[model samples]
Target: MAVIITNRSLADGIYMMEVAWEGVVSPGQFFMVRAWETDPLLSRPISVHDYQDGVVTFLYQVVGKGTAILSGMEPKNTIQLEGPYGNGFPAVDTPLVAVGGGIGIAPLYYACRKFKEDNPKKKLRVYLGFSNEAYRVEAFDAIADEVVVDVGGIIVGQVDVKRGETFITCGPRVMMDALCQVVPEKNPVYVSLEARMACGMGACLGCSIKTAEGNKKVCKDGPVFPREVLEG
Candidate 1:
């Protein structure tokens, strides 16, 4: 369902938090948002970074047309959102390691906030990697234990992957794959995928990901999924 909320900008192009919603919004759930009515495209899917009180927050880079519009809104301004969709990151009672890169950092932020609430006793570690220190998400510092950013901090190439017993992520395929390789096949590992999506639902059948269980939708079935499921 669509909920109207007042939005605020924390930074000119990076941070923005929203407050105003009537119901529960869980970790890893996304909001379908449309900031400009004149624009031809429909609402864009943005993952919830964290929500407290009646406020919901999102941290995104100005990477596209839709997000650029969203990044421009002022405080007390209202925006439309349809939301809290898709399966969330599975609850892990044990220690969890969250890894992220670039725009993919939002999902892990949501997870860390939830962990602090639900599993206060468990050790929750968070790691973030960006192309360089400049592009890194500093917001992760509050949520993560040991944050890393460097060309060679965790894994290399176009991906940011790290494996600890209990781990989850949202980033490029190459980064997720590197983390998957280190985490034992038997151990539980969750990865939030960023696959191309024409429609953020299963109807388009556009975000199918090759899996052991067969192709899966990155939007409907995921955006969050088990790492083992991706291993061939």
Candidate 2:
């Protein structure tokens, strides 16, 4: 069990929850968090916003009953946590272009931190899009070499997509689909997907999505997948 350190609202319904954790967790990995006991039987998968100093942070939007409960949780309250599950973004030596929409920016923030730690000289460009005002802009700006924000327009169109560039992104399906269409065929792109999940483990066939390869489990196979296989 992880103890909640802080749970504060960052935006309208979006909350940032910091918990005391001990283990190494990668950027795109997530934890199945539950603040209630039996009321909302299953836990919610929340992406790692940042992890440092034995504290792991998660950015969540309070859209449902489970999240609403999480939002109301106070400091020192212990919550059930399952894992730092799912495959994270690959460590790339090539320049990285991270594009995120709304809450999708959660994972990218940590990914950028890892990239900068691995290769400080390499370029790390971050592009974040929001339907209205942006949250955590200062946070992204701290780790990224360059930061771009789009409030009302298509942020995908602003991406230059240099040849052989690597992109790591996550967002609403429509936004991801649009960005995938814009990315060059030769360029490599990785995306973190979201789905309704009953169990964080693979036992339940809950988080499955059809891809060109076959039906893939988001909870096991990946919350992160290559763009080619997903788009194909």
Candidate 3:
């Protein structure tokens, strides 16, 4: 169990919650979070927005009953956090480009920060898309060589896919598909997918997805996957 350090609003229906966590969390991993013990039967999988010191942050939108409950909770409330699960974005030595849309931007912040820390000399660019209001777009300025924001339009068009550049993206399926269509098959493109999960663990087989390699569970095998695997 983790204690909520802060629960505040970022924009309408969007929230940033900080929890006291001492465990190691990778940039693209997530936690199955639940604030109530009994009311909601399942925990919501929330991507790690950022982690610093002893706090793990979650940037989420109140999209359903579970998230609505989470948004209503106050500081000091105890919540269950089941993991730092699944494969995270791999460390890359090449110039990196990260693209996110709406709430999918949650995981890219930490991923970009870590990449910059490890590869200070390499170029890092970020593009964020929002249907309406934009938040935290300025935060990328510190870590990215370039940052671009698009409101109410496709953000992927701004990306200049260069050879030898590694691209990682999480967004609406349509946006990701469009990006993939433009990227050469030889370039490495990683995608983070979203699905409803009954159990964060693989035992339940609740979040299985069809891939090139038969079937894989999102909670166990990935929430992040190579673009090629998805294509096949």
Candidate 4:
């Protein structure tokens, strides 16, 4: 269990939650969270938005009962948090391009920081998509070389896919599919998937999906997978 340091609404139904946890975490990893004991039955999975000096933040949308309860939680409230689970985005020396849609921006923020920290001279580009109003864009200014936000239109379209580039994205499956349509096969692309998880672990088989490789568990084997693995 971790203690909530702050919980505030960021946008209409969106929230940013901060908790005191000192464990090592990687970009694109997630945690199973819950403030209640049994009413919701299963914990909700939230991605790591940002982490620094023993504090971790999560950005989420209150789309249902579990998240609503989480959003209502006050500072100092203790919550159950299960992990920094799943494989994280890869660290590469090549120029990094991160594309995120809506709440999917949560993990990419961490990825951007990781990239900048590893290679200070490297160029980093971030593309964010929101249905209308935008959020957390200013946060990118500190770490990214370039940041572009698309409101009301697809952010994927703004991406200039080129040969030998490396791209990473997370968002709705439809948006991800659209991105795959235009991206060149020669580019190394990674994607984080969203799924409803019952156990938050691989044992339940609830988040299983077929890939070109075979069926894999999103809670354990991924949430992050190479685009080639899914396509090939």
lDDT of 2 at 137: 92
Q: List the residue pairs that clash in candidate 3.
A: none
lDDT for each candidate structure: 0.70, 0.90, 0.91, 0.90
Candidate numbers sorted by TM-score from highest down = 2, 3, 4, 1
TM-scores for all candidates: the values are 0.83, 0.98, 0.97, 0.97
Q: Write the per-residue lDDT of candidate 4 for residues 64-102, one digit (tens) a residue.
A: 999999999999999998888889899989988888999
- Candidate with better TM-score, 1 vs 2: 2
Give one digit per residue, the lDDT tens place, for model 3 in 41-136: 888999999998999999999999899999998899999998988888999999999999999999999999999999999999999999999998
RMSD, each candidate, Å? 3.5, 0.9, 1.0, 1.1
**Clashes in each model (backbone N, CA, C under 3 Å)?**
1, 0, 0, 0
The candidate that wins on lDDT is 3
